[model samples]
Target chain A: MKDKFGLQRIRLSVQILYTILTNGYVYGYMQGKIYKGGLKYACVPGLNCYSCPGATFSCPLGALQSALNQRQIQVPFAVLGFFFLFGSIFGRFVCGWLCPFGLFQDLLHRIPLFQKRKQLPGHRMLKYGKYLVLAGLVLVGSSFLFDGFVKVPAFCKYLCPSGTLMGALPLLSVNEQLRSQVGGLFGWKLGLLLVLVGLSVKVYRPFCQYLCPLGAIYGWFNRFSLVQIHWEQEACISCGACQKACPVDLKPEQISVSTECMKCGKCMTACPVQCLHWRKIEKN
Target chain B: MSFWHKTLDKRPKRGMWFLLFGIGVVCLVIGIYEGQLEDVYRKAVMICLECIGIG
Candidate 1:
């Protein structure tokens, strides 16, 4: 019980810290301009909208797709390197601890108003959904699927619930100009947000599990991330408590780490013997 | 497994990490060389009107 309480506190603290760090410019909300300072050139580790009034940094995924869609095809080394550095270092640790959207989903999942469903139909198969979004929508669609006129960042334009939540909704609420511009796209995004809200109430991070391309990218690097969860196999009793406590239902005893594991430390709290611990991988 | 899945494989030694860091540094240097820092700053200063499907 003490461990669980500590974990909860830690999660709450991290959530609040990330929120403040990413959106530190509280004055920007009053000014109604995206914070365009030197901080804007940096990318936060999590999904933050560049257009958010308070955001001081650009969204890495947005920067990536935007750069990729350019006709000249210059490699966006900053964005790519930013992704490579952080993704390899922390993996989905940011998703579990820092992302505003991730925190929102966790909060929604805690409402106790909806029946929790760990697995929906085709749940196992749906694990690949994020990869598909990353490849087909973000990369290939941007590169090849222009309508012979203009290329759209299809993932952000059509799909990114974060952009809808942080960018579109906020802009429309504040700017009268944006209010008049709302059309089918806005309606579609609103519908998507509503559906996500409903799902998050019942499901654990459905968007992170099955939709976020950035999550998919970070997840890909989890195996080599500097911070790793190491289990002491010798101190083992296979009570299966870790699996029960895992937010995404990943079995802790599995040989391969599930890409879906966000390293949320819930499993560690749940472990009766306290066999799992976070470790910095060492140089041999 | 596809190439994507290979990315999740654990690196056996420090050499692999050095390679990864090397790649990151190369990219970072190229980005700086291309004046992308200035471009990114410029991009940040303006709101992307079309990004949220507003335009």
Candidate 2:
């Protein structure tokens, strides 16, 4: 139990530190302005809203959408490369340790407001929704859809709760002009955000499980990511402790190379025989 | 056995990971050369009304 708590504490600390480091533009928050610095050229490897007042780096999904939405219709190599780099290196470790929105969901899950639903109905089927979102909205809609003069970033415009919570609310709190302009669309997004917040209290990482294209993309690399969880079959005692410890209700051995494994390390701490451990792909 | 052969035989996944990492680096360089960095910066610096759900 002590080891489990210690690992969780370390993960939470890393998540907080990463959030602050990526969104370090203090002046932007005070003045209700987005950072226009050189750092904005790079995309952070997490689901942070670029429109957040304190954000110093760009959101990868937002950047990918914008790149595809341009009239010139060029490939988004930079964003693709960014995904490849981070995906191959960390996989969903970013979700567990770096993403601000993920941290928000984690904190919300700890609220103790209602009976936590360990598994939703059609959980396996529902997990595929994020992939569909990535394919339909983020990729196809951005590439082909247009709103008169400009192309639409469908995911950002219609579905991103992160934008509503981190970007819209914070900006509206300080910017009177922005508040005055809020209309039906903002209300729609706020409603969506509220629903997600409510769902998060009961269902762990509802957004990551069923909606986030970014999470879906990173998940694909889990099988071959440099950092991974290795289940040592030779030393195995099938105690079932790791499964109980898993917040997502995954069997650690079965999900050694699975997309659903967030690499949260809770299973590793729970293993009594210490069979499960973190292993770098490059190491022997 | 040679070092490379031994390593590959032990962990085939390592080779694949390095290949992907290399490809990522190459793509990033090409993107930079094409002024994609500037493009990203321009979009990010602006307060995207759509992202804020106000557009």
Candidate 3:
């Protein structure tokens, strides 16, 4: 009973934290004061978009795409630096807390009609799917290697629901010329989006769990990344409370901060022995 | 509704394959309607790029 109570509190706390990150801070930046000059700094953390109807800063993905596609290859100094800095410092914390699209999926899954299931043990191999997407789609498909400097943002083109929902749809809806020009490719993407939305309703974070290159990149740092989750194995009795508490269905004590674990800190609160703790492994 | 039945079922895989086949059929139909395969390729690129913001 006490454990369940603690789990509820932790879940509530997570909801509160997510609300602040998604709707409060990021939203404030989106709708806040207008700048005097041209545009503000190009990059900010947590996937908030500069072009978003309510966004304050530029989206990292969009910035990276534009930089790569530029004529001079000016090195995307600010964009690459921001990605490296944030990715190394906090790892997958951005996915857990700030991404507006992640928040959308969370809310959709919370609807009573959506069923939740944990694909465990044998299904672990599926986690490698995202790595392939990063390698095959983003690096290879986007390259256009034979054509010299022609790079496609393959992930955004084919897979990203966020790009569809936040970037393309909003911008396209207002532009009548674009609306008149929709073709088979748009139909394909719309089809893909529908499939992904259905998958998210059925499975938890279907995109992040399967094909988010950014998630795959940060997850690589789950071990050596500056942010770390440590377990006192000696203190732990394998009570399984942490596992029960995990939203992503991770076994936190066994593999805290695993690529699948979002590092949301729920398991920390669920630990009865207080064996699980977070440590800042590297300073930004 | 049984746990084993749910996990072991090939429903998701079958559904995935069916969706792919359906998409292929749609592509072929679109090609036929347009009277060529070339326009289909351009259409695909335009659509994909539209989603990615170039279009």
Candidate 4:
């Protein structure tokens, strides 16, 4: 139990440290300005809003959508490369440990007021929603949709609660010029953010499970990523403790490399016999 | 098992990951050459009204 507690503390520490490092532009927040620096050329491997005042790196999802929204309609090679690089190395581990929005959801879930549920109703079907968000909104919508002369980053514009909470709220609070421009769209986004916040208090990572396109992209690489959770079948007792411990309620033994597995190491700590362990791909 | 069978085992190999990583690096280089990094920087430095749900 002490080991489990220590592991969770380590994960939380990493999450906090990563968040602070990525969003290190303290002056931006003070001055209500985005960071204009060389670091913005590279994308971060998390769902942090690029518009957030403190964010020093570009968001991969926002960059991909922006690239796709160009009038010439070309493949976003840089964003794809970023995804490939991060996805191949860390996979959905980014979602589990690096994403600022994910950390926000985790903190919200820790609020003791609500009765926590491991899985939402219709979790099996709902889990596929993130993929749809990636395909239909980020990919297709950005590639084609135009609002008059301007192209829309459909997911970021319409659905990203992270943008509303982290980018919109903070910027608006500090910038009087921005506050004057607040309209129905901001209200709608705030409402959506509230719903997600309420849901997060009861359910674990509602955005990650059903809506985050970035999570969807990283999830595809989980099975093939260098970092992986290996299950030793021979040493297994069919004890269901790991499943109970899983934040997403995944059966770790049955599908060790399931795309849904975020590599959070909860199950590793939960296993009584220590059958599950983190392993890198073997050199042939 | 034959060499092919051994190579094609279910377990993920480091070689495959390295190849993918190489491909990612190549893609990143191509993108930088094409000025996509500048585009990313330009977009990131600006306050995105759409992201903030304004206008």
Residues A196-215 of candidate 1: C-alpha lDDT, one tens digit per residue: 99999998989999999999
Native contacts kept (model 3): 0.07
lDDT of each: 0.78, 0.87, 0.56, 0.86
- lDDT (tens digit, per residue) of candidate 2 on A1-284: 55854888999999999989987788888889988888899999998788999998999999999899889879888988999999989988888888999999999999979999865689989999999999999999899888898899999999999999989998999999999999999999999999999999999889988889998999988777898888776787878888888877876554446687788898889999889898887543
lDDT of prediction 2? 0.87
Q: Candidate 2 lDDT, tens digit per residue, B5-54?
A: 34334443688888778888988988999999888898999999999999
Model 1 bad stretches (over 4 Å):
A1-5, B1-11
Give one digit per residue, the lDDT tens place, for model 3 in A1-284.
Answer: 25534644554466556545333433323433212222333344465433333343445665555445444444444454555556656668767655666666766666667457645244577888889987876655555432344566665666666656654566466655656776766667777777877766767777777777778877755544455666666788888988887778876443434677777667777888888877655232
Best-to-worst ranking by DockQ: 4, 2, 1, 3
Please tell me the TM-score of chain A for candidate 1.
Answer: 0.95
| lDDT score of residue A214 within candidate 3 | 76
Over A1-284, each residue of candidate 4 has an lDDT whose tens digit, in order, gives 44654788899999999999988788988988888888899998998788999998899999999999898978788888999999999989998889999999999999997789977899889989999999999999988888899889999999999899779988998999999999998989999999999999999999998888888888877767888888776787969888888988877543436677788888888889988888886777
lDDT of 4 at A103: 95
**By lDDT: ranked, best first:** 2, 4, 1, 3
Q: Which clashing pairs does model 3 show? A: A30-A54, A30-A55, A50-A57, A185-B47, A186-B47
Q: Is candidate 1 or candidate 4 better by TM-score?
A: 4
Best by DockQ: 4
Docking class of 1: acceptable
